[model samples]
Target: MNKQWFVVYCKSREESRAQLHLQNQGIHSFFPKIRKEKIIRGKRSTVEEALFPSYLFIFVDQEYTNFSKIRSTRGINDFVKFGREIARVSEETIKRLENACHSINDLKADTQSLFKSGDKVEIKSGSFKGLSAIFEAQDGLERSMLLLNILNQENKISFCNKEIKKAES
Candidate 1:
């Protein structure tokens, strides 16, 4: 039987624990994580978090691997499924994820803002799509404030990081 990758749904914040238990059972598993800066009790800290919370991948040949044992593994809830069938991940997808994980892990913590104040940016989506604006400041990890000129008045507006991009000079 050919081996394939399958996703397992784990209890909240238990992906690492599940991965460990799977390894102890001699099962191959992949848990992708990323380093991020977060504020803990008002103090800045660097932490590693699962790229996909509550999920991890396992390599198994269904015919040989004990399904019951895997489902009963510590911290694992069950295999992800589509209705009555277990979900399978493609080898190419796993390879891409592994490559991305390596690149993410190799990156050094950058303190510099992605967009400096006064930098020009363009709204990529939402009602303001295609509009150019001036970057004001980062609102949070996933948001930013921009100065949009409308009717000869500059208005401050908030947008998600994905909704804005650096405008070509």
Candidate 2:
């Protein structure tokens, strides 16, 4: 059977439960999780929770007509859809999800904060050295920036993620 990654929709807030059900039925399933800290009752605690709260992935025979059997299970919501058909996620996407499940580091939310408004900064490296670009916003950590081009300056380029450093007084 050619195995393909398919997104399965679990009942609202029941991803883990559905994964367990699939396991009991001898089907392969995966539910990605991440550890995050939250303040509960004014106390900080870490919890390992589903990275995607209502979804999991499964591998099954493409020609299997048993999709309805899975869909009718108690905790299963549905297979993810593309209009009238189930959507197939790429193998690469599924591998990424698997990596997240086995990682020990804290899950990172995409919230890189770089340069801000009204901030005075200098480009520490790259072709724009000595020319100060106004600190704009975080461009993924190592590089943060401001637009060097005024209007007609098409030659100005966006800085690389590793090309920026904050200017000092």
Candidate 3:
């Protein structure tokens, strides 16, 4: 069979360990991570975390590495299985993920742009500086309806465009 990329499941929160194990064994693998700034204990810090937690991709070819060796690898639970079949991922999909990972690392995370409907935005100025709300639409590019939660219920309020910023999430 031709070499194919297949997703492998690892123990909870063990993606990095699993990737290290695969590397020591000389297996080809990819583990995508995203870098973001977070306020940790009142201090700003940058953390690189897995884009896909608890899952890693491995390239397996029957001509070289045996499937059993990969299955018995440390930190790896098993091949992601569907019924009795182990699904193979398309090369194009893997390439796209790799490119995205590269671009994300190269680009800074603080980019901002025009707000759209259903976009979660945080009030950056005015009386509600820290509140997050869902954007509805802009009226004449000045005011827009923001859906906010109060008393466990959604309350739509209109606020000017300059008072809001896109939520980090």
> All models: lDDT?
0.88, 0.70, 0.81
Worst 10 residues of 2 by lDDT: 105-114
* Inter-residue clash pairs, candidate 2: 114-138
Residue 136: error of model 2 in Å?
Answer: 36
- lDDT per residue for candidate 3 within 75-142, as digits (tens), equals 88899999989878999999999999989776642223467789898998887889999988654334
Stretches > 4 Å off in candidate 1: 109-169
Each candidate's TM vs. the true structure? 0.64, 0.59, 0.62
Query: Which candidate leads the pack in TM-score?
Result: 1
lDDT comparison, 2 vs 3, better candidate: 3
Q: In model 3, what is the error at residue 144, expressed in angstroms?
A: 25
Ranking by lDDT: 1, 3, 2
**Prediction 3 global C-alpha lDDT:** 0.81
Tell me how candidate 1 scores on lDDT: 0.88
After superposition, candidate 2 runs with Cα above 4 Å error:
104-169
RMSD, every candidate, angstroms: 5.5, 9.9, 10.4
| Residue range 2-99, candidate 1, lDDT tens digits | 99999999999999999999999999999999878687898556689999999999999999999989999999999999999999999999999999
Q: Report the error of model 3 at residue 168, Å.
A: 28
